[model samples]
Target: MRTLLLSLTLAGLLLSGCSPLPAPAVQPTQAQPAPPSPTQPPATPPQPTALAATPAAVPSPDEATPVAAPTSQGGSLPGGAIETLDPQAIIAATLRPDAPAWLIPADPELADMTRYRLDVTLAPDLSTLTGHEQIRYTNRETVALDVIYLHLFPNLWDGGLQTTDVRVNGQPITPTLPSGDDILGLPLAFPLPPGDSVELGLSFSIAIPAGEGVGNYGEFAYQEGVLALAHFYPTVAVYDAQGWRIETPSPQGDVIYADASLYEVTFTAPMNLTVVASGATLDHAAAGEGEAIWQLVGGPMRDFNIAASADYQKVSLQVGDVTVNHYYMTKDAAQGQAVLNWTIAALGLYQRDHGPYPYQELDVVETATSAGGIEYPGMVVVASWLYRDPNQRDFFQSATAHEVAHQWWYNVVGNDQLNAPWLDEALAQYSTYLYYLDAYGQTGGQGFLNAMDARWARVGHAAKPIGLPVGEYVNREYGAIVYGRGPLFLVALREQIGADKMTEFLRQYYHDDAWGIATPAEFQTLAEAVSGQDLDALFQEWVYP
Candidate 1:
């Protein structure tokens, strides 16, 4: 299977800082870096061509398995074997525990997880974030390693971060050129071979990300005292079948599965300031004076994310013994109930249908600027203006549903969002529609179907074959093929097979691929196999010919 590519384009992020790696120190013994050249817009590279062959001789039933449907046919995704499951047991298990603990493949160069900690400071006044990353990499591989490479993540930022210095276990490493790229970027890189369990500490800074225009985020806008802090720290890059999944720009959010880390993140702000973040907070007491500590202890997240708003009003609710907190600017509080009500409804439906909420607390905040509602592990940040409109419930409802569903699709049911975007994006978008169907019946679903219809009408005109890798198509075109056409195919297939059977098939698919990623072709194969039908031609029409 082709290695998946995942990226989060936190572009148009407003930043101001000097050029180079970052002010914080990086791993030492590095090559010497050249003087900073004038940074310019990067030219797009030729898209990837097909690597695996086209579909060949059909598989015999005796040889048939879900794996053959996708991976063997020039398609990507590990397409690993499927497993049977008990639905009741799956539902009863906590969402965190329910995920498959994907075994770390026996790789010779990398070490297993030991422990990690990160301290990051964001300077709103400077629009720059300073961070310190600490991790223990033990060389479990047989080879004796020398140099190790580290990734300064969220490298997809428009201009990327510039590091001023680096230290290796406190020893400084020189550089040939600033260790990075424009198209696919990671701020710094280190070298490592084998049998070395060592600690890596790095100090780096990225311009505080804001969107294009003033208060403009991707597809959303910002309000007062609201801040969206993302890709704000140095992170370990991913290397797999496709090599280092470095600082590349991808349309969808990132596809990450960080092993484990103990995080002690602190935010110091003046009094009356409340913040909502990714992990647990150590609030010794609820004091209502002076500056407060927004301390976080993130247990198992690939990266840590947090949003702060000094003007935010705090509200809390409990859903099934799990506390759900909300932070929004005071002025936006007028419509806070609207979001809270819908979120509660969506949460209840998701738990009943798929699984339980995994984390102890779920935070929903209104960011100063951000894309449409985006989910981050247990927390979610969404635009408040959209939800405030009483008539715009469909947009709010669906966005809310989409982000929440991401908790299951990308977070637990892990898949690479870059190279194989269709895997999670399509699932999250459509699942929201499913939730709408469950809640408001056919009418609620019609809006999404209408969106699909609009997407098809717009994209079908330019009808590029969906067979090409996701990055080959325009962002909008990919949306049409994956989110619109893909779900419509599923809806049609469901009609062919009774819902009872289809639901069972979905359950099985979920159980089998819990921690695994997938490709579109594999899904077609599974749908056919589960329904005792064929989808070859269907895929030919919708995805490839």
Candidate 2:
């Protein structure tokens, strides 16, 4: 158990900006951040050699009694540790109880989840990509399915994406043209019954737009030597309570959601280019003529992302069984190390409070994103600008901690972000407060909250509900509500519920929702249960109203 490398000097510096550090006064709804002033790209440094060839040994389990897994409407969830359960008793005890049925199956079979195996090639100049994929999708819903939907999210960019030769189980199938939406509807020859799986095959190509990213969002285009690909692939759409999430891309906030599944993705690019993606790279081989192939395996993860560059220098630090890696250029080595150090500390704090991080490796890479950073499952992409100025080190540390918290909130505990932005963003923001409080002392944490209050009073006081969708808030109100006031609501909740009980409530919530989606209603039910207090008025004033 290594502690965060926090020194009094660094703590003093981090305490400077009490408000959400570095976010614009009027923040954009989308995560894309305004580009920093252009600076010459730094030369890549040599990659760090492996320090130990063997995997780090796992720590002995703690001596405390293992808490029994919480019971749900069902007797016991699949993969959950055995525990006594009385569904009716649990339901009757809650203040704001949800329906008896679980949103997703209580015992979802991982073998029946959607899985993808992709082999893709990137252009030498990083301008284009050609890909072929084999998809295995299951109909986990109760109803028979007539159509399969694939979201070509990258089409939201200029020049967009092109697809050809689509097939289902090796038989040729015609895909309906892009339906003015980002969806590609593939009608099955016959209805696929529930609990059945379908194999889909497709080939497509994408042209990477070049230039500064749009609307605080860094462009998908090639810049310096890096090519960032977020929604670059045709992702499967989630079928949930609202039906397939086929909403067109909006410049503000994320619009994608899918069930966690397995991925075996192989990316081919110029031999000199280094590919960093959601999962660990399993193999790398040269393809001759200055090209190579990198094979990756990731998931049970919500989504997969790839960021490749020829100039990335890599470093790693070991914490328990997990290895934290930082990628940056020579000029940004200090900043990259700063992110790594903060990530290690945040990871420790979150695992202790929430749950253990299941992944073996966590990556933090320096790239150009519209926002200060974006969280993937096991990896995070941080804005290159944060590494430029030494004076901005505190902001850099804050942003890194915030995104690392997302590994628990958004990545593992999936939520319908499009519908309830606060469920993840607000929780992640509040977790940052916990990190600072635990890392620094009470004075430092209180100061951070004071800054947030100042910002909220100035701009976010008019926000309708803390749980509104991304579209409901305009301009800085998104940050003010989702990031600022939303967390304040949690702080207020902690005030009502004793601190010890608050921690117990969150741990129970995280444990119950691990590897599953959680709604505000579900959270409310659990909160009341853990605190032994009816929270109707509190939730109404801060959460719903």
Candidate 3:
């Protein structure tokens, strides 16, 4: 969700101007009107176990044996090829058998990427979850590492997370929560050298919080039968030049800052519920009585998220090889259909303007969230309330486009959203403008731009720098500056350069930094390079000033 209050302001601003273009009267080429199989009888839940009982000595690239190519189901290759010392089995288990070929990175530069295998079960009441996770963490920094930190996001909410059976390299170890309950620090028995990988395992149970009044747009909560699970697991903290990024998240911005990693998850849930998650589902099978297990795999993704509900109805369309699913309640069928159409339009526009979306699937789900929309890896969550309000349709459409834009800005090419919220949020907002321009022409585009100007007007159009940390802004200032003034800066840059150069810059930035972390400095440097002009003055006036 961007800012609910700003969304209201934007709705009025757009309604006062030219109305948005009518949605294209196109129907899905294929639709799934029925839900999945009914709930089965309950059975015994699976227990957590280490992916590999004993750690094996990983071979160097030269000494590694060449494995067979990935099969139809996404297969894993030796991590040695990518520069990590993780065993081949660990890598194999992390990728989905049905993962699209493009989702796997062939680049040698991404060798130190993390890999995770998770086996979790959701309770029948949607009130809690129990799981075990195995992580392959590589020390990508130049220096050796003594301790690793994991962010326990649920600890900050109403209900909490309890972790047990912590182990490192098959050996039991005790973990400490040094920086509050949220940050779990594991002291390695031996310092992990640079380029080396360590296997960590743990079992956890989370008491899912209720959505109302919860923080971060209530992304990690259960509300009205919908479960929005974002950052519900133990996520490794990012270690960069600033050392560990474990700072307490401000109430105004996104919380998770992570590296692109591979994930293989087996989630068991009540059969009556429909689960829409990041990546492609390789298999859906009955686990026991009224439960089913979904086998999913995604790679080179910043984070993983899942939205499950017993009441969800789905509509699907195939855009090329990508399967787009829109999940919503029956009462919101019209809005859900509109969201699906807009999502398809935005996906096509972004693919043409920025770069190809590598994933094989994309999901836009109507969730019980406070924010307008929240973007995940291959999925985005649209707030359900937006569907019930006829006057808020404009904001709803724009928010949908904005979240889809995050596929490129946040998921494919990530940044430190805590410190540089504008890196993705601003770009996403600008991309929403482009979407309107492409889909609805100048009249539609101008109306949306007018809404942005209105948002900036909330702060009296201050000349504040768009490059401030989330904590630096208070109240509505975070939305006013970052979401409002920041995108305007991008429009200004487009004017300073040329429309053609601006387009080139976006494509190059996305392609070059795909599945990698980007910084403001790198963004400016790329702009200068692509435009063949120094961008110091422009960046200074808008970003640094």
Alpha-carbon TM-score of each model against the true structure: 0.68, 0.81, 0.83
**Candidates sorted on TM-score, descending:** 3, 2, 1
lDDT of 1: 0.48
Q: Which stretches of candidate 3 lie over 4 Å from their true place?
A: 1-104, 107-111
By lDDT: ranked, best first:
3, 2, 1
lDDT (tens digit, per residue) of candidate 3 on 1-545: 12233333343442211011122234224422221111210111122121111111111000112233333222222111222223233234333335445545664544567877778999988889998887879998999999999999888766699998888876778999888899999889999999898878888999988757563466888887688898888999999989989988876677768999877677998877778888666567777988888876666688889888777777666676566777887677666456777788888889889988877678898887777788888889888866876545566778888999999898889999889889998999999989867755565566567778877888899888999998898766778788888888999999999999999999999988887889999999999999999999999998985
Supply the TM-score for candidate 2.
Answer: 0.81
| Candidate 1 deviant stretches above 4 angstroms | 1-116, 124-126, 137-160, 164-171, 175-198, 209-223, 251-264, 270-272, 284-291, 388-391, 461-470, 513-534
For residue 365, model 1's alpha carbon misses the true position, in angstroms, by 1.6
lDDT values for all models: 0.48, 0.66, 0.73
lDDT against true structure, model 3 = 0.73
lDDT string, candidate 1, 1-545, tens digits: 00000001101111100001111122224332221111210112122131111121211011001111111112111111112112122122212333333322122311243334455555535356566555555554455444444544445444255554454444445522235442222222344555555555555666554544332243121235556655455555444445545444344434343323334455543333345667665442222344444445553444456666556665556665455655666666655554555566666666666655555567777764335466676677776554444333344445666777776666655655655555566666667667756654565466456665555555764545544555566645665566656556656666777676677666666655543455556677778888887767666765564
Error of 1 at 434 (Å): 1.2
Write the number of the candidate with greater TM-score, choosing between 2 and 3: 3
